[model samples]
Target: MITAQTFKRGSRPRPFLMGILNVTPDSFSDGGKWDSPKTALAHALDLIEQGADIIDIGGESTRPGATPVSREEELSRLLPVLKELIPSIDVPVSVDTMKADVAEACVALGASIINDVSGLGDPDMAMTAADCGVPLVLMSSYGDPSTFRTQTIPGDGVLYAREKLAGLTEKALEAGVREEMIILDPGIGFGTSPGQATEMLAHSSDFSLGRYPVLIGPSRKRFLSHAFPGKDPDAATAEACEIAASSGADILRVHDVGRAAERF
Candidate 1:
């Protein structure tokens, strides 16, 4: 399981695995497959068994152009699964939502981490994470939520990601979140142009905000879709994971736990 000690600088050379569990019907990948509480719980256990250090569960689809679900709707889809899965799993579970209310509710249900892909899209998200005292994953995504996938980096992707995360980290600190409990993600492939995303991912180590652990989610993203297209799904994902790890990513957010466990 991931704790504050797990994220200490120089503690991890190879990135730890954080499996993705999206309980939404519109996620670009594997959507509608595990939206049910029972199936989600089963998949969570399977992931843990397959060597997942953490499980990140999201109720709403953060895929580009997907409408944001209401706070209540998100909780409705996420809470029941968390209620059944938290007590059953040994590894940590992170609630992936930009809404502060959803994060709070999940934390109350014993969630160990908060992964806000919006990088504090909800004004109170930082405060909620601080109040819950859980590790917060602030992924650097630019522009409006509606344009997350199509948003273009104004300049260098690495610089943009780093600067954005740095500002968000400051906000989190001022909101009472300890610096050690903070984690950073470069939001690889969330924006436009495969080349831009590739550059951001290649220099992932440079986006380390607050000197915190960097978590890269390059698993099966569109940017990597063009690489080795006809190969097995995990083939490209494994390569991306290797790149992220080699570039100093501390956590790998991915879908295929079995393949990552085997390779990493």
Candidate 2:
């Protein structure tokens, strides 16, 4: 089993359950539910009790047509909650961001992992990750949220994700980020069509699991909305977790930690 030492945080791995904590008010799902620090921290504690191995906090909404939040606003929403929860939560905290400054600040505030949806597209991201001595969870996506919704690409999503991740891996290596500190994510629903997302779900083995542990973040994604019409997004998320676990994904980034834990 891959452990934190296998990646950036020097963390030990045991079927990591990454709980999603979206601080934005416009996230595709459960956006406004936990916008406050008190509510967010309570939810985080509940996730830990329900078996979340990691807490992934995000301030910006990356959903389709989502507007970007300013760096100051993003940090304002994130740092207070992080400062309050970092000492209270037992699991490692992963700050979900693409901005170098935001990531550096979060790491400085005790975040153990950097979950970059851009796959370190920012030139300074890798350097900051290396400097912070934290593990980086790099997700493979072709474009930002707005562009992702409009773009289309061919081939299996897993294959494309693998190719993109391979390039990013090389870049991170060149930037002095240790290979063991990097984790690969297929970026479900980020830039893929529903068909491609399903293909990746069915064939996640195409990713380079030997080189880096695979992280599958399919919780309440738009692809799931299309795949399981008339089903609850939470149930669909649980289903995705089962599929991911069986498909060799080492970690599952999800919103419903309790349900996913039961499935696991």
Candidate 3:
């Protein structure tokens, strides 16, 4: 349901919910819960029923210190689920990947969006997105999952995010992606500290890249847990969603799609 008109900047759109469907055994939040195709498909359907506007499917875990999966392994895990789920879903389907090959394959298999948490770090990633003619969620991140956790945090997190996203916006545009197909994410926990993440959330609107829509994914993140000790991560994630909605986020990527939809 996300289109070029739906992503206009300078004006906030009715916040749309992007449900997370991780078909991996090592994702930080719901590892091993929906690793199978049957379970993953069922969970995705449930999310759509609960009001998810988009379904983001990921085969690899981008958790801190996580081991990176091979391109073939990632393809193995995702293609099976996407092959079946895309044909059945009513809303748009996105593939969460940083690999150019994986992104290309998924788009060919009917994915509408490519959510790259690495901010187009891969040289071919931007080109793949352009060739597919799908929207790309380029997050402000220093490196891949294995190295992002150890990257240096800027003293001014909001400023750092804005600058990084600006540079990435140019990269995406130069690679031939249409301006409206680029969505910017601040990469809340990728390399940010607890305070840094909070700062970015507080200033989400400032991180927008010209006319590009902003997608905020603070769902069940470690920074949220660190902010409220002993509090339920789901509750914290919901609170973050509320903040993001008010701060000009056009799309919210989350695990609890129903709750986020209600909050938005």
Candidate 4:
């Protein structure tokens, strides 16, 4: 029973798996297949059966070069599914968004966590999470959603991730988010080259800013292709999960919860 309230900064006694459910038709992987609420709910249930500790629902695709959607469009796609699915699932639900409004709405609808990939790019996002009293999963990304793929590399991957995440943690705390409720993530493939992504993953244990728990999402990412070349995405993702787990990641967001959980 891993719930949003259960995870303290570094208090996770076991690795937790967050199953990803993309409700967008343009997601880089497994898009269109679960765009509808009915299908998305089914997939979420399946992930739970597969040992997922939480369900992360995303309406817009944030893949490299992905077309950005309007706030209204993102809400339209997410609210219906969330409204229908939250009550049915036993585990906590997390909304993946960079918008404060969306995060607020999802929290009102019973979502337990806000998984912001843009590192709280929206100034109001931090307030929304704090007001909701839910955990905020902040990823390390210095670019906006549109240009995240083309951001300039600062320096060494691990150091860059640490600095960026440390900055974001300050922003979150300044916005009134409690220190223990903040979780840090080194955005694995969000704005990093394949080599950089690998470097970040290898050093995920160091992403923590003081007491913040570290989360890593390297599931089926394009960066894995650099290592596996032509290996199966599932196998590669499982390997990535194992590495992340061993490197001190408290949580892992992945497409295959069963396989990822097994690595722990």
Candidate 5:
């Protein structure tokens, strides 16, 4: 199970596995397949059996150009799964949301981590983390989460991501979230073109996470298509995960926990 201490710089294991579970109907990958609470809970349990160290559940889709769901809609899809999934799973449960109300509700019901892909787009999100004292995953992206589509690309992907992440980290710090309790995500494919995403992945260690652990969510991102054209997404994702682990990423957020656990 994951705890605030589980991600402390010196105490972290090498590339712990975080399995993805999207309960939305529009996520780029595996959407609509587990939108129901029963199916979602079943998948979460299977992830644990597959050697997942943490299970990440997201209600809204963050795919590029995807439409955003209302807060009420997100909670309706999310809360039910949490209510049934948390008590049934043994591994730490991480709620993937950018809204404060959703995070609060999940925490109250036993979520141990908050993986907000919006990088605190919601004003009250920072305090939600501070007040709950749960580990926060601050992901860097330019546009809205549902549509992380970007018309402009940064010249230096590393510098751009570092600056974005640094700013978000500052916000989290000011909100009273401990540095050790924070985790950094490069937000691969979240507002980046294929090249930009690749550049950042190649130099993940240079993000200089220090006390804050770095998590790389390369799973089945579309960018993988460029890296390995003929390769299946899972195969491409596995290769990318290997590169990320060798590059010093502390956590690997993946779709296939069984394959990842076996490789790592």
Candidate 6:
């Protein structure tokens, strides 16, 4: 079980809220509206008021088929917002990036967590997190944004994700990252179909694999779109998030904080 001390070092034994702040022009939801530092900070504060435990800020759009942004462009978009919000927000700040440079910079700027969707496939990423001594949330994905959805895996999608995450966790630990400083996310909708995502959520315990806390992000995903074709995608996404929280996930990464908090 994850204790308070472990959490302080950054691990959660129970479900926690991780609010999303996408600082990109092409993010699937609320992209340009919060792209600027002022608006982003305001939105982050609003999420905090609505019961968010952590704020995950991301500059690049990692939605499938999305083009990669340059490091300079990503940093320009993220640092300003992070600089403003870090001082004002009461909860931990997580920078969502796969690049080692960006991760290092964010850690230096008082961010406590590194949410890497690449699972530290970039060799320097794990070393960077270890060097900075911050908690790292490693999400399991088959590939990068460019070709992730094209990759094929054997067995159930949730089990495949779990196996990949397990391997990454071992690699990260071996690379000098403390065990307590690591968290696992199943990467819902990253490379799986709508049915696969649902199956993963239904059998989330399988992803736990062992004692590590599982972090789930089901907010505003394409899977939710397919799950509720006629209803509002946003609403369906929030419902999916609620299901994840109720199904033994340790953290819920969401865009609609108010609705999510109400559901919780």
**Please, what is the whole-model Cα lDDT of each candidate in the order they appear?**
0.83, 0.83, 0.85, 0.84, 0.84, 0.81
How many clashes show up in model 2? 7
Better of 2 and 6 by lDDT: 2
- The best candidate in terms of lDDT: 3
Against the true structure, candidate 3 has what lDDT?
A: 0.85
- Name the better of 1 and 3 by lDDT: 3
Tens-place lDDT digits, model 6, residues 195-248: 888877776656666666678888877777677677676688777876776677
lDDT: worst 10-residue window of model 1 = 1-10
Model 2 over residues 56-107: C-alpha lDDT tens digits? 9999888888988889999998999998989898788999998989999998
TM-score (C-alpha, index-matched) for candidate 6? 0.91
TM-score of each model, paired residue for residue = 0.94, 0.93, 0.94, 0.93, 0.94, 0.91
Model 2: lDDT to the true structure:
0.83
Q: What digit string (tens of lDDT, one per residue) describes model 3 on residues 10-45?
A: 443558788999999999879989877889889999
Q: Candidate 2: where are CA atoms >4 Å away? A: 1-14
Candidate 3: how many backbone clashes?
0
Per-residue lDDT tens digits for candidate 1, residues 127-209, read 98888888999988767657766667777888888888889989999999998888998888676467777776667688775
lDDT of 5 by residue, 169-195 (tens): 999899988876788898888778888
Q: Clashing pairs in model 2?
A: 3-13, 4-11, 4-12, 7-181, 8-135, 8-181, 9-135
Who is ahead in lDDT, 4 or 6? 4
Residue 163 CA displacement from its true place in model 1, Å: 0.7
Local accuracy of candidate 4 as per-residue lDDT tens digits, 1-264: 333336542555557888999999988888888878899899999999998988999998988778888899999999999988988999899999989998899889989899999887898999988888999998987566566567746778788888988889888889999886888899988778788887776776798765677888988887898866777888888888877777777788999888777765
